[model samples]
Target: MRISTSQFYETSSANYQRNFSNVVKTGQQASDNIRVRTAADDPVGAARLLQLQQQSNLIDQYDGNITNVRNSLGTSESTLNGITNILARVKELTISAGSGGYTDADRKADAQELTQLEEQLYSLMNSRDENGKYLFSGSRGDTPPYVRNADGTYTYQGDQSTLSLQVGDMLTMASNESGYSVFEQALNTSRSQTKLTSPLVDDGRVSLSNGQVSGSTQYNDRFRGGEPYTITFTSSTQFKITDAANNDVTLEATGEGKFDPSKPGGVTFRGVEMALDINLSDADKPNADALIAGHTFSLGSKPDEVSGSRSPGNTSSSQITGASISDSTAYNNAFPGGGAVIKFTSASAYEVYAQPMGPDARPVATGTLTGTPATKAKIAGVDFDFSAPPAAGDQFSVKVDNHQTQNILDTISEFRKALELPVDKDLASRQKYQGALQSAIGNLESGANKVAEAISSIGARGAALDVQADTNESLKMANTKTQSSIRDADPAEVLTRLSLQQTMLQASQLAFTKISSLSLFNRL
Candidate 1:
């Protein structure tokens, strides 16, 4: 297989050019320290790098969000701490004022102090976070949490929806709590009574009769009279009356006026014309006859009597036209006075009276009454009237939400009340309010703690990301080394190859020159 001169020259030139081109390409790649500078260089690795870079950027964004949430939580914690302090001061003032030794002026001073404290607490509850969001407001963080009215009541402005933060891919934690749960629902300070009054009265009496008498005649014929009478009571009070037989007769008041002689009225005496009268009075009064005279009495049946005799039963029933006397006799000894004694039926309904006591006067203090028909007496301000019935347990509760603005005002108002109340009776109330405040504090703390936990989780994730980033950087370096080994050229190796190629190209040119010179044309 003898190679032709033309063929050898052509093949050697091609081989030399190819080797030179390879050396240039490898040298450029080594200088750049990259195997795949573009997608055309290595499509798979370039795409993977792009995806990793995007993940890293997302991690950075998450870190920024976690930082913001952490700052908000910190602000909330600080504000709640301030509120806790104010509540503590209020408790102290309540204890001081409740001692009963404080004069009215002293109490007033205490009240003023409490008012200031309350205002401060309100401000704290309505405080804002670093992001200009209300700390106690649930989801409505931009609005104020409490509002105060001219009537001295507070309204809530926050909503019940909770605020939350995403700390991880699938983890979320609460960032805020509602004002209603912290304030209104947690603070309950009312009580009720147990016993109730019966709806019945006891003392009711009536009598009735009819007859005719001759005024200036020698004689008159006998006649008979028929009468019907009834006395209805206001309530079901129990009472007893003595009949002519000296037997005891018992009676009770019906809610309605239903007179049944077989049930309550006494039997009639025999063989005499008698005057009839009825009396209704309290069973405790000393004078009963003065209460009884000329009052009409209801009778069950008719009676026979002699005419022209002095029959004393015919009279009007509307008015008691007899002389009024404060006599204790002639009526049953149980009558006291012509008055009604009303009683309350339940204790819870009776708390309306007790509530006034907290605001009006201290248990043993001397203060002027503010209501009508006022009588001045050395009376305990805690006295209550049970003349009306109340419902069972006397429990009532109210809840308010969306109170971002009003929460502060309400807290201040309650704190002021706790401070101004009489020290003697307000100890329990103050303690109760303190408990409510503590619960609010706890809610704040819990929210803050959750934020803190999220922050911790974020920090952990950031640290892990940092480690991943470091590992990625190292892997990138290793990949560069592998690429260099696979496709890049070292300067020494490229120089050697270039020299060998130059030598071969020079040899090829010499051979081509000799071959052309030795051709047939040169022989001729």
Candidate 2:
């Protein structure tokens, strides 16, 4: 084969250049320790490395989220501990104030101290996290959870929504508790709003007093949901108790619903006790005792809905709005038998009847239109405003609701008011004070129990966060190992390949020089 001198030099030069390029590439791989520098190095391995890298980043982000959740839960738990301590102190002060020897001035001093503790509780309940967000404000981290009202009571401003953070690939954690759950929705077991049914004809001879929940567990089981429980006197010496569905509940306690008013004790049923005083000596045997026999007393019913509607026969532009229960006891008394109707005697004068609107029934309450459109009106204990005045004979009817919960702050505020009041030695004053004190103590205990429950929940969340953090650490370690294996170069293999390529390049250079010099001119 005949070859030109230029062709021979070109082939030799190409061989040396190829060997040198291999040495430089292998050296780069050895220095960097990366096997796949680009897609061309190893297409499938490079794609796998990208996926592993994304997973590693995700794990890092989850670790950060776990830290944030732990901080939030820790702050919340610390704040709740402070609240628990304050509530304990308040309970101690309250119990001490109940001593009969403690004068009004002494009680007032206790109230002043309680006020300070309550303020502290308020501050703690509105705690903030390291990020300057309110801890108990639920989803409304920027807003205060509790606000003091003009009446010196605290109102919950936050909602029931929880703020949750993603802590793992498939797990999310609630970073905060709603104030409503932690403090506002505590149960008031001592609530016993008692009233006589409207059907009882009275000459002010019968009085019910000391109405309270004597057994918390039984009372809660029976009356917590505002279920209507009624006591009806089958006779002057006996009464039958029935539930909302009118099923005889007294039968469960005693086979026969029997009571002797002549006995020293009052009527007791299902953890509730109330003193029923009847002037038996003054009783008009056939008439007064007969009224007592048919009389019904409803206990512990709550206001669920307060609304009004205009009568279809009404010829006026009158409409009622903002109807609500101002006093639950009065509302229950007003509608023990049924609903109430507002009948206009004139453009400005109105009468309220406890029964449905009818000509024969007498009015139970009366009110005068004060505004041009008669803006303000109240019936029994329900308050409502009117948009316009009704013409003569126009009527409106109000309905009752049976659902409500007293918040923790309201319970504390009520106790504060009772402590601040000065009670005389009179029987009525002393009895009233005793009742208020008893109710306040029961409610405070309920609030304390609720706070404890919240603390326990926070602790559980903290434990869960700890577990997630450890899991994330394990996952991070595993992911790092996987990434290194898929994308990193073996140091020994790269260095050996680089050495071999360098030696080959040197041999190619020496051979090319020898051959190039020995062309036809040099050989001749």
Candidate 3:
């Protein structure tokens, strides 16, 4: 083939340029230790490398999240430990305050210490994390979990929303626990408060044991939210038991049997059981006969927190304040069907009706509200003070439920109050004090157990986080190895390719120079 001098020079220059470009590109690859500088170099491998890198980055982010969660768990665990210690101390002080040798003055001293411990416990319960978020506040991390009310009772404001953080692909774990689970759900003290209401009979003449709920299912079914049970001995040998509504319950609990009075056995009703004790001897046979004839004793369990709400249809400025279950028996009587609703017939007069109030609903009890700033009244078993005279037709519903869990802080506060009060040297006062102390101790122990469980849960989550972190690290290492194999240039191969390309470029340059000089243009 015939070729012009210009064509020959052009082909030789293009070949030389191509050889020079290869040498420079190989040298850059060796220096950078990268096999594919761009997608054009290795499209499939480059895409694979990108995916691995993204996965690695995601793994790092997940590891960071795990670390944050672990930190939060640690803070909570430490705070719970502090709470456990404070609860132990409070229980010790409560038991010591009940010592027979300790006088009222000693009890007051213990109360002072108890108050300080209570403050400390409150502080710990409202502990904040490193970032100033409340540790046990659940989803409301910025808000305080437990707040002291005006009446010295503590209320939990935080919700039960547990925060979770992702530690791996499609995997999440709880980072916090709600204060409700940790503090508000402690075991309820299972003792009844007994009152001898028969003015004619003295407590000394006939007394009963401190009652307890022996059967939970029975209690729940029959107690009717801690309705008070009244035992009335009709005669020396024959007695009758009645529920809150004045209905006889003798057949359901135990068969009617003659009591010798000298050998009085236990009486079980609803799910509660207590022994009747007669302090009168044979010499006091007349008193014993009188006690059996008309002596009446009422036993009732302390209800959980009482909640009252104004009816939405009511147009009134009046509010129910200091609402409480004053008498369990009456309270149960009030709710024979369901909840109790206080409907105002006039501004001063009101009537309580059984729940599911209808036009034909009958009032269970009727009373008139009259007093100063607050008018105190007892309906059924519920007691409440009215803030202002309600409008005619204004209604309020009161609900008293059976005790399931006791607030830890409230338990502490109640114990403190008991210690602070002055107890007279009387049988009644002594019995009251002992009952209050026993309830406080039971609650404190249960509260401590709850805190311990929370600590254990935190520990378990921390361990799980550790395992997840390790797994992430392993996954990251494996990804890195795959990324390296696809995207990294071998040191020896890059160096060898660079040297060969340089030699080839040099040979091309020398050959092009020799051939160009011998072209027809140079011959001319």
Candidate 4:
């Protein structure tokens, strides 16, 4: 191992430099705490930390999203609560107005109050979020969900779409309820009385059912879709049905439960399920004491469909005339129905009335229509043969009043109007509303229940958001801990290694100084 002085010095210098570099690197690691500041320190650990960092950022974003969801859902819940409270108050007012002792003046005062309440309801339905977006407007957040029509009635202008937000990796939640579901699609219905009565008497009663649009095989369409119809008793033993407008519907035997006069207690008129219980009455046949001779007749003999056209001379054919039949009423007995229509009984008058049985009838709802309805007015799901004019609250349509629900709003609104019945109109008008108020109450309750359910759904979503937030937070903490384990260096271990490197560097320098001195001067 003989070496020149220059070679010895160069080798010693290289050794010293190597030990000094180790000392610097280890000292830096001890000072910094982390094992890998860059890929050069620990390539695999740095790559893994990068992935974890990205995950942690995503978790933070999800948490932010959860916060927004809570805010939006909380707003929805609060708004729905307000609406429910309003409905409750309306229910209270309706009950108070139904009192028999309430005078006309008193009822008028109630109506004024109700008008204010209706306006309040309108405002509540058109609620907006803090950001000025319509809450119930669904995906169309910028547009107003409800609009007051010219008739003073409200209409839903928003589409039926929900707004959803991503709250977690696999979780998404709906943040808004569509106006249709919250306001327009409430679970209310106008069902025909569970039991119906079909009388053979002139003033006899008959119940009508809301016919299906499908015109199902069980019960087919018997009358026109948009036309008003009448079933009149020509005698104590016979009755016939006539269409007041275009004949778009007809009776067919194809359905399972079509009008079968021959069947016992199973009779229908124009697809309307009729309850027939033939009964004999003392008046059926007057004794000889009262008339020339004793005449006895059966109470019910299902009369065949009257086939004929409108003519002054013919009575067998179905006839629709301006002639008002006995006991004509504004209330249609057959129900369980859609469509909200107002009909003018008199030719183009502002006065509106309901004619379920005949032409002459007392108006059930008395208010101002913005004008005449664009189409025929519907009451209890059947068209009212709309006549133009007379100002009232307004003639409006509720498609939610579809066949399943009938025109429940018409029934309820009419019941409300009846609260302020006029003395001049038929006293029977109040009687009709008085009888129907109970059923209308049931419908209102149903609507309220639907709103409650929707509110509950929103609350549930809020709860889910909380759960996702907690889950993301836990996941984020775990990711941080794992990243720490992979990238963080032990302080004691780093310190020890740094000290050893410094010692090595010091020893290398002293050895190099001694060896270089011997090779040049001491060697001589």
Candidate 5:
């Protein structure tokens, strides 16, 4: 076939252009460290590279988020640790206060120190993050979690829900615990009580153990609570009881132990049970008989306001000796109104009288309470066993209740109260202080456990974040390597390809020149 020189030159020129373009592309790939500069270079590889880049960017973003989680979790762990330490210190202080050796002044000083500890605990509970967000406020990050009430009580103002952060594609972790759970709920120490008081034990022959409400299921079912009973022994063998409504209780020896102030026996009259100590000394006989007088002992549904000599119900053994459903429910029913106050008019009597109730409240049920070594006065469900010589005018009281604060606050308050109490405090006062202090100590251990649990969860969340971060790092490294293999050209391979392409281009140009010059003239 006869080929024209022009056609040959055209073909050779096209070859040279192709070679030159290949060399330029290889050199660019080597210099730029990329294999596909545009989609046209490698369509499939370009799409894959795009996907890998997105994955890499996502991994990097997660790493950043994980770093933030770590910071928050670390801060939470440290803060909880601080709280636990405060609890430990408070526990130690409580033990010292209950020793019963120190005077009221020593306890007051300890209470002052406890006040500082409470402040520290409050500060920790209300701690904020570096960004000024309350750590324990749950999702309500902008608001403070705890607020001090007007009554000097601390209240939780934050929601109970926790905050969480996304740590992985399908994983989310709780970043914080609610303030209510960590502080308020866990440390709740408020309780219901039916405390009692004992008469003066100045007469050694008449030693009185603190009195308590054993139980009167019938009394609980028949009468409203918070009512005090007035037991007036008409004689050594007989007595009469009255209620807040002035209802009369007939004292018939229905139980084995009868209400005989002259001997030991149990008397059950109108669902109330009391043990009578007939073993009274000669001095106690008149005093025990004097219990026949009206308003000998008063029982308030509320706790007593017993302060140093300046308080009500502070004379003689005017202290809570026993606590039960203080013979009535008329007390708990008196909410939003003044608390019930049950005071004893005389130390010689085991009878309690209901104080005047609000106009709106129902009259409290009153019944006779006689105590004996054989059958003790049952308050609530517990029994009271004691032997004491009574003197007329020896008084005691039973107050309803107070909402004591959490472990730290209630404990500190009780300790302070004990310390400030006079050494001449009635036997009931001493027992009450000791019981409250001991209860506070028990509550502290549980509070510490809650703090520890919170710290543990924080640790677990931190570990999870660390694992997610590590996984992301691994994926990032793999993504980079795969991305390089798909999009980048090796320098050595690129250089070699560029050299071959240049050589081919030069050879094509030389051939084109030779062919163009040959023609029919050179052949002739």
Candidate 6:
């Protein structure tokens, strides 16, 4: 092939320039210690490296999530520990109170200490996390979980929602406990003196103008002919009376010495009903009377006759003849059995009978009694009546339900007040309360243990995640190395190739210079 001298020189000069550029670029790349600076240099290596970098970033994110979960669990654990400690102290106080040697003053001091402990428990229940969120409030982390009432009751303000965190793929852990279960359920089932006894009359009777017993009086007859009458209830609620025909008669206050049958009354069976004729002139000591009215017996079917005389002057002048029965007959008719038996179906429930007495007259025989076909006794403003016979040697159980921890503490305080027996008797009573308190403490401890175990489980999972993250990071690094080997330029090899290119460029430049100098002569 015939080639021109000018063309040969031009091609050689271009080759020289290309070789020189290659030498410089390769040398610079080798100095930088990276084989591929851009995608264009090594497309496959660049894509693989980017994938590895993304994996590394994901590992970092996983690590951060694990950190957050650990922090949350730690805070929760601390708060739960505090609650456990308080419960332990309460258990100790309960044991001390049950020793039977402490005086009322001692009990009062213990109660005060318990009150403070309850307050501490309240504070613990409302503990916040590092992020200013309530730990025990469950998913409602923003609000306080426990609310204290004026009557020393506690109300659970938080919902039963649990907060969950994802620690791994398809693995989640609960980060919080429900305040409702921990506080509300705990408070409801864990104390003594939980129940109060209110006076109730079954088969109640009133005077009638007619011969047969009739409810045609101005005052409403709550009971039917055959159904038992419920005169009072011990709860903070009103009594419900179901007639033989299943009718409800509601009663409320009307005026002085009167009751409205359709309204709600404020008198609870266990609660004292005090009527105060408040004189604005005397602020220190107000005139107070027992708001509760005595049971009145009469001879007519009219309830208004209940407020009238018990018997007429003469049998001929009487509306109902032979209505004036003896107190023994009345007591027998009301109780059926002689009024000395007490029946109990459970610890807090019992039934007994109250002997007939004149208005405002205390019963001659008023003491604790228990047997079949229950008896009634008046003690400490409570009329304990037993419906069924209790187990041999069984006593009436008192249970108190309160809203707040402090309210439960106050209920204990009331129990201490109600127990006015000798030290041994009081000790026995205190033991009953102590047993209940111990049960409550056990429940709390069990809950706390469960929470702690759960937290530990979460911590283990978090630790596992940390290991996984580390492994993933290592995998990413190895993957990056593989990608570099496959497509990235090796520094040493690149530098050597660059040096060869530079040498080739130098030789091409010298040859081109000689060619340019003798083009015409060489062509000839």
* Global lDDT of model 3: 0.77
Candidate 4 ranges with C-alpha deviation above 4 Å:
1-18, 191-425, 435-439
Minimum summed lDDT over a 10-residue window in model 4 is located at 300-309
Cα-based TM-score, every candidate: 0.42, 0.73, 0.75, 0.62, 0.59, 0.51
lDDT of 3 by residue, 164-248 (tens): 9889997898888899899877867555656778855474766666665566678778775536778887777667777778877
lDDT by residue (2-112, candidate 1, tens digit) is: 778778778767765776665565556546644556776668766765665565555555555566555665666566666666666665665665464665467668779
> Who wins the lDDT comparison?
3
Please give the CA lDDT of all the candidate structures: 0.42, 0.74, 0.77, 0.55, 0.58, 0.46
Better of 1 and 2 by TM-score: 2
Cα lDDT of model 4 overall? 0.55
Off by over 4 Å in 6: 1-14, 162-488, 521-524
Off by over 4 Å in 3: 190-202, 209-278, 281-402, 521-524
Which residue pairs clash within candidate 3? 228-328, 228-329, 330-381, 331-381
Model 2 spans with C-alpha error above 4 angstroms: 196-249, 252-268, 271-297, 304-383, 386-404
Per-residue lDDT tens digits for candidate 2, residues 1-524, read 98888899899989988998898889888888888878899999889989888988888888888888888888888888888888888889889988968998998899898888878887888888888988887888888887774446555656678988888999999988898787767766555666678465654444455455667677667655435777777666667778878777776433357655555446566776666665565546556557567767786633356667776678977788678778879766765334567888998788887643334788777879776556787666767888776789988766543322455667777888888887855555655677678777777887888889988998888888889889988988998898789788899989888889999999999998887778567667
Pairwise lDDT winner, candidates 2 and 5? 2
Candidate 2 whole-model C-alpha lDDT, 0 to 1: 0.74
Evaluated at residue 473, the lDDT of candidate 2 is 87
Ranking by lDDT: 3, 2, 5, 4, 6, 1
What is the C-alpha lDDT profile of model 5 across 206-306, one tens digit per residue? 21121222233544455335256545445445555566777664433253213445454554443433333334556666766454322233332234221
Positional deviation of residue 513's Cα in model 3 after best superposition, in angstroms? 1.3
